[model samples]
Target: MTRILRSQGFVTALGALVLALVAAIGYLVVFDPARKTVAYCAVMPDAVGLYPGNHVTALGIPIGTVNSVRPEGTGVRVDFEVQEDRALRGEVTATTVSDTLVADRDLAVLGEPGAAPWDRSTCITKTFTPKSISQTLQGFSQLAGQLTGGGNPGEQTRIRDSVVAFEAATSGTGPELNKLITDLGDALRAPDAAIGRIGGLLDSYSRLMSSIALNWDDIEIVLMQATEGIAFINELWSRVVQLIDSLLVILPWLNSIAREYGRPILGALDGALPGLRLLSANVAGLQQLVSMVPPIVQFFEEVIDPATGRPQLTYAAPKVALPRAEADRICAALNGLRPGHCDGAENGLSDVNLVSLVLGTVGAR
Candidate 1:
């Protein structure tokens, strides 16, 4: 006993234990181990595999560990012992997640930027529970089993019959089905052009809708006015129906006339086509010429024949009567090879007025 008490090994061991205890006590004093603050969150009943000592993260970073999780009324109240410096804010949300399907869940707290400060005294009202991978796999399994009818004889028979019918219906259409599939793939792959066109169409439709919205009042007024015209339109429709009946009665005769004389009428039009084309070419000049006709008619009215009680179409330097046929040809004779040819003939007049014959030709009487 004396040897052991005096031994350097025992003394060294004792000094090590003393040093470790002092360091631990210093650490506890410095870190304030007794007074941890907690934030509370009410979590869903199916926190699946969450437990005490599970790491709690805020925004994916570890800020604390779940201190306790216990049933509070209907749901579970989870207390998280968080570092006072890393407390969550008003826009924070807590959820339970796990890294692997079989792993214990961790409470994941997320916070929004620029949110109001979270009060430590108040608990987060709700928690989000994400669907677990096992649940997803179970659902997929159920669907697969259903599709295969879960080995039931009647269901299997029905599935077989349906597949047989489908096969029979498509038996002769392999090439068509192959072509359809190829075309469908091509269409789907080339959808960028279609999508661009659809976008343009949507833009045009949007503009059209906007235009209608802007002019809705005017459109309503116009529609109201159109509604007021329905009575007039009804009367007009009756008259049109009568006119159509009359046309129907005359149609046979009209058709016979067309059949017999269509060629001659078309021939006449063909002959006049050159004149019509010429008139069309000189439309502006023809319009100007037509405008000058009124003045010319007025001038003819001023020159009236007192003796004949008509417009004096025939005017000469010395007035005299010639036969209608002679008067007609007098202008031609004056225009001929002999200059004074008319003077030697009937009344020794120097000339017959050429302008008078022109006026007479134009129905100035």
Candidate 2:
């Protein structure tokens, strides 16, 4: 063993073997294939400071490494691998963040773990790439140039003065600004219950809009009918206004008439009240009398001669044989005398002689 150790060739081979072992150890430490990891992807609008092999972090703690960064269409697709044990689980957002202006950006996985594991098929589409300080400053410079470039010098001066004043006003209020920011943050921080209510409200509003869209035709018909009804109401209102105007014009005449004759008219009505009451009480008799008027008018109309415009009288009598004594009695009674008090009783002639006059008249006819 002493001779082998002292040989120059053995010593050279031993040193080479030690170097090979060290290299293997370094390779295993650098790229351990046995370490389990979960693969994920993210698409970002911009990936300026991000590169392959960059650290992927969760809440600023390193948990993974970016596998690749490549352009896919209009976005940058970032493929990453996280330690399987520390895999991002639920709905999460990826944001590119940097520690400083010059520092390299990292892919930040933000959110707490949820019930389901992360879906490998889907990419993290919800990503934000905030503008770097240099980009922001460049944007401001461009804006300033644009404002000052126009020929309106007064406007340019005003804008510049405004910016200066704003800077001056905000320069020394650091504590107040901090307080304002804190308050704003507090105000924006919604509780779980509030968030749930907001979500429910949005869902209800969505359903309401859908319902309106579906019933748009019926709603349109209702609106049209309402419009027609309004027009009719407007016309009726105009008529009412005209009636009111007419009443206004006639009011003075009515008032004058009332002043001139109202007392006499009231007095007459008061005097006739008993008669009016009696008439009302005999309304049935009045109705019967009114009923007889039509037949009387008909009889008069039948008796009138249309050609001569005069009334014509006609009579028909039945002939009857009466005893002479009874006839004489009737004639005497018609003359306002008793039967025995006739002036010509033996000759059957009275002072008036109505029976003989009627017989003579009939005989002559």
Candidate 3:
């Protein structure tokens, strides 16, 4: 009886061991920590504390763990084995976050999310959105450049201009500027000379000023009168502008004066050039006639005795035209009179005839 009991006990112990082994394997299949049940793909610049068999959690609940971490192009690819019921929505951010206490940055997530019913059986890889340190650093650097103005396109040009101008002003280049300082030093040393010169200048200026000040009342009255006259003139000018604009024909008249009359008057002066030449020759001859008078009479009486009728004097032959109305009109026009009006006054033919004036003014070598 004792042997049979021992045998039964041995069989039961063996059966229990088999059952525990089967249970462990079934537990591993259904909730395998490394099998990537309901897996998700996350990208990270570096593999965040995640490696094969690293634990994962959702809302502090142990949901799954990392199954595999592999290099993926520029970044690393990580696979997480999440629980069947755990939810990971689009809004959730996956990043490698760190704490001062932690030796390495941890693979973490935020934004509590929902999962699909079909996601339990196979790997439903929703990409985990991760924070980029490089992008953050780039943004910070760009912002710093903008704030300092040193990175502004033309800021360096402005700084260069200011520095160059400062250097130029401090450098001495001109004699007048050097002498100005020298003169100031001398004047400060010789106070008497400076004071005497200043006094003399001031006295002269004072006398002139006194003369002006003595007539201050009259000056003020004249100034007031001038101001009134100016006001009247401005008012008149304004009215005249209105009237002129109303009479638009005046604009064409002014245009014609500039185009036609202005050039022709200069041409008219050129046309009268021959007459001017003749007048100059006449004046020169008149001067010669006066100088030769005494010599001529003596020659006539001495060389050709009129008492013997032996051709005492040979008359100087000449044909002179009398001044006609047309010639006078031309002369008057040349003399700067109204084109056709000439009273033949002294101004018409004076000590300075038209030819002498024209030749002196316009015909100089």
Would you give me the overall lDDT of model 1?
A: 0.77
Pull out the clashing pairs in model 2. none
Cα TM-score of candidate 3: 0.27
Candidate 3 — which residues are off by over 4 angstroms? 1-4, 7-36, 97-106, 112-365
lDDT of 1 by residue, 83-114 (tens): 76776766667789887778888998876656
**What local lDDT score does residue 93 receive in model 2, on the 0 to 100 scale?**
88
In model 2, which regions exceed 4 Å deviation? 12-16, 19-23, 26-31, 99-104, 132-134, 146-151, 159-365
Model 2 per-residue lDDT tens digits across residues 1-365: 99988999999999999999999999899767678999999999999889998999998888899999999999999999998888777787898889887778899997567657878889999899989778899999888777786557667787778899999988989999899999777767856667889999999999999999999999999998998899999999999999999999899898998999999989999999999888767777867869878999999998999899798987654333334566566555644533332344344433443455455455632
Per-candidate Cα lDDT values, in order, are 0.77, 0.82, 0.65
- Candidate with best lDDT: 2
Check candidate 3 and list the clashing pairs: none
